[model samples]
Target chain A: MRPAAPMSIKPQADAVQLVLAALIAFALALPFATLKPNRIVPGQPLFLLDGPPFWARALVILALIALATVTWLGCRPSLRIVVTATALMAVILALGSTAGHLPPSNAYARLSPAAGFWLLTGALGLGIADGFARLKPSPLAGLMAVLAAVLILAGLFSSGWLSGISILREYQGRSDVFWREAVQHVWLAIGSLAAAIIIGIPFGLLCHRRPRLKAVALNGLNIVQTIPSIALFGILIGPMAWIGSHVPGASALGIAGIGAAPAFVALLLYSLLPMVANTLSGLAAVPRDLIEAARGMGMTDRQRLWKVEVPLALPVLLAAVRIVLVQNIGLATVAALIGGGGFGVFVFQGLGQNAADLILLGALPTVGLAFVAAVIMDALIAWSAPRKGRGSIA
Target chain B: MTFASRAIPRLIGLCLLLGLFLQPQLFEPVFRPLANTSAPSIYAQAELWSLALSHVVLALGATLGALILAVSAAVVVTRSWGASFLPLSRSIANIGQTFPPVAVLALAVPALGFGDRPTFVALLIYGLLPIFETTLTGLTTLPAPVMEAARGSGMTEWQCLRTVELPLALPLIVAGFRLSLVIGLSTAAIGSTVAARTLGEVIIAGLQSNNLAFIVQGGLAVAGLAVLAHDALTALEIWARRRTRLAV
Candidate 1:
């Protein structure tokens, strides 16, 4: 008889094993989706076996079991990751197909993902995320994965398969409102960020020029930062309302207490810290010798700032833009509480009506938008960093 | 002079918050004019002290939970065998940043059910990233020679972690904790939408009734509490930093 080889299980497989086991348990224990009569109605859970055909049940379970076994038996990280990702895609496909099984005549009938569905998605996601962490791929690798997932989900949405999901039905009913609010959400986030940059950069420069000013300016900003964002928005309301009514033409310009104006101002205030801090740091990073060389070349301070200093500082400023953009995207949701239209309009409406699907209608997109913004900003920062690396050495 | 100046804002904040909680009527003189003629000048739907108490509970509880989970995760990922988790941790931190606390708090209703529970869960989830990232930095950035010396003295890895690494990292960890607590303080206010009895309840009630006084009261309480908490944490962080230096 051949001697069994010594056990040499890899360490990284431990987390994967746990994820797979949890995935299978969730699949077995809970329903994959709920068959709802309508958006607001609580529905019966469709256990994995009940929702999908025999083929899908077998495929999802079999894939998860195989991955679990392979990891337990020990395998290379890369092989495990590819198999995990493929398995993940398979599970997602299986989830979508479950919707197809629903009768078409039941117009308002929809599939709300139950615990089984979410738990399965979460477990598989952890596996793939674990893979990403372990693989240490290029910096853009994670962003690529995000884009790929978006593409796949987008494809699924466009195919009309997902229309049976409760959240989608909610979207179907208010598709136009959804898009408009999404655009408004983006506008609120970006508009405030733009306003902040215009005000913050020069303020940063002024502070950098005067030592005493930096202390006072940073202290004031710190105080602003410490204030709760919602409170700031609320406090601004009374004053802004007064201005709207008392100040001539303020209402014409949409400068009111409760609308986008106060939300915009509050967001801009929240955004200034990152903007000003980054600008200061970026400008401070400019090499003294380089500035002296610019001076020796007969370039005025303004010329040097606009030309040499600005180019080198571009990356840091872009970083600030990224932070502010992502942050404002999130804060803009709160604007809805104050009658400022954004994704939060759906979220708060959903809350008021106790409709989870409606809230998801608002939240899912806000999260997606913020993440996409982050990835794009990361790419820009990476792009800028390398090109400007040469200047730092000098 | 600098100390007194630095102390003033936090002191005033603490006093204001106390007055709001202990004697809501004291602010009546201030808020009366702001109130509409018919409506009351204070948030009367709930006990001001209890709401304040629950808000503290939510923030503190979430911060504690975050501290344990995040610190453990950081400790694990920094280990050689746990290296794979580093990227997962990084992405989580990144995603946490991308998602607003309000959206996160709202999303919890579906999965966790509404009320304070989901609110606590949301705050816990959101609070994790700051502490985790900061803990990772603290663990990784310790002076190399100090580590070498610890190993030279025959300290086991566990001993080194408990006795040396942790103490050195304490200040940074506290700073991270401070950040989480401050963010949680306000985020919990938003949790009022989900039935969490927070300072936000006051503001929401005010909004619903168009009571300017109630809104101002809630807004001031939350802001004051945040400033007070920020100062408290900053002091703790400085003390921890000083302790480590003194030991060395």
Candidate 2:
């Protein structure tokens, strides 16, 4: 057998890349770390990190670095690496808890003010840089774009009245609170998105191949889309209740009246429309000649799909994922009503408590997450898509 | 069939009215008598109309607020350095959408509490993403050549945007608006939870009183509102597209 080529990751050369990756990974965790539930109310100030002891903060930072390093290193590793990392993390958290290092506040302090700021800035800067790099333009376009961007960034940064620093600090701290609530909310949203993609893509494929099924699926999804989230939740309640009562193992799984089960099912149903529509549109957009060419090349149906059609259609498919993602983010909020707990806890809690500030706490992060995800997903979709002029959907 | 299509929604509206008014036997069980004594369900009374109007006020205001924030943000992003922040903005928007509307209600309840303000706030946040995204998409898709041509003729960026981009993007923007409005309308039902009068009040009342008719009536009203908005928007879009096509 031929020997494999030498593997190389130049240490100093990789430092910049590693730092960039580390910064982003850390930023993603910032929001998670800051997410917690305590002294939360609207109007009255609720600190994201309400003045924890100094040592606690140090420990938190250490834990964050440890987590970040482990996660980063873990990515390139084999099975043994993962097993070791998991064991280490478990031990650290266990030991850390004994030494009072496990609490969120300690985690925050450990993520030193300087480090936190650096990581946050670096991640955002890199994200913007990456965005610009992808949108390569003519000199004129580049110059004009840069000038315009600088002006806007300056205004935003210097919008002294906006008090962005405090807002950002709070934002970081709230990320901790969000992290707690988002665990389930994120799961439900992702679960729904996955289910949508699975169900919708196949249905779209089936519809394309079968005329009768197409109408049924199309009309069914359309009707589903039209039903408001609350009403959809209401509709699912009855069926879910029946399932809980009659199904063999539903009760064991805690399929109660209002909770994750009904919420998950409802969100999955809600997600079907866009996923199906986008998949159908993407498949249809594939050129007829291409498929025929594949056939002429003596490729079987399966091979044609795997080789030609899907490659051409992937960008659109990813765009559908984007749509479902945005849709899921919005609809997942409603899951709060049925007790499928998530960031909605903050919103409902804020509302129930009559706290606008608290509402802002919940609402702002949600809006931020949605916008960021859409942009990132759009960028990914654009990158993955077959090179061409712009398509109908972004 | 075309005429029927046009007439059916109106006819449904009429039948719904008649079903409640003349056919007492049909709706009585569902719409319990308003007073314990023997009156018709309050949902069929003048009180319900007033309640619905109040709900409309809240919904419209919230939707308007959402529109202002979404459109302004979208325009700024597309027009200026806002582009740099687009990803972050999109992410924020996602979070907004993901943050549950009910939670907004609950969260708002504490600050605004038991009134229209909280409902308005919730609806506004809930309605933002579609309009924001659609507006952003519409603005960005302004044919670059058209903008260049206009710019070559010495039109300023603002002029180019106002004349070429805005006009072209209107249809898509309106589509987003329509979506937001429908969503806002349906979600406005949550307003009933805090005591603002709306069609939702009918449903909630029915729930409290165990009157199915009230629930049906409320639900139908909500559905009717959605269809009306959808049709109106569809018609507007057709007109706008035709006009744009003719212009081109």
TM-score of chain B of 1: 0.95
Indicate the worst ten consecutive residues by lDDT in candidate 2 chain A.
A39-48
Candidate 1 local lDDT, A1-394, one digit each (tens): 9977766764345653564576668666888888887778788878877677778778887787777766776676667776776677667667777888778998888888788877777777777666666676665776787788789779878988667678888998999999988888889999999999999999999988998999888878877888887788888888889999999999999998778888988999999999999999999998898889999999998999998888888999999999899989989999998888999999999988998989999998998898889988887788777444465454
> In angstroms, how far off is B226's CA in candidate 2?
2.7
Tens digit of lDDT per residue, candidate 1, span B88-199?
7777686677888888888899888888999999999999999998999999999999999999999998899999998999999999999999999989988988889899
How high is the lDDT of residue A354 in model 2? Answer: 52
Q: Candidate 1 overall Cα lDDT vs. reference?
A: 0.85
| Model 2 agreement with the true structure over A219-289: per-residue lDDT tens digits | 67765666666556554655676699999998899886557887888889888888777777878888888
Q: Model 1, stretches more than 4 Å misplaced?
A: A1-14, A17-21, A58-85, A103-105, A387-389, A392-394
lDDT on C-alpha atoms for all candidate structures: 0.85, 0.62
Best by TM-score: 1
Q: Whose DockQ is greatest here?
A: 1
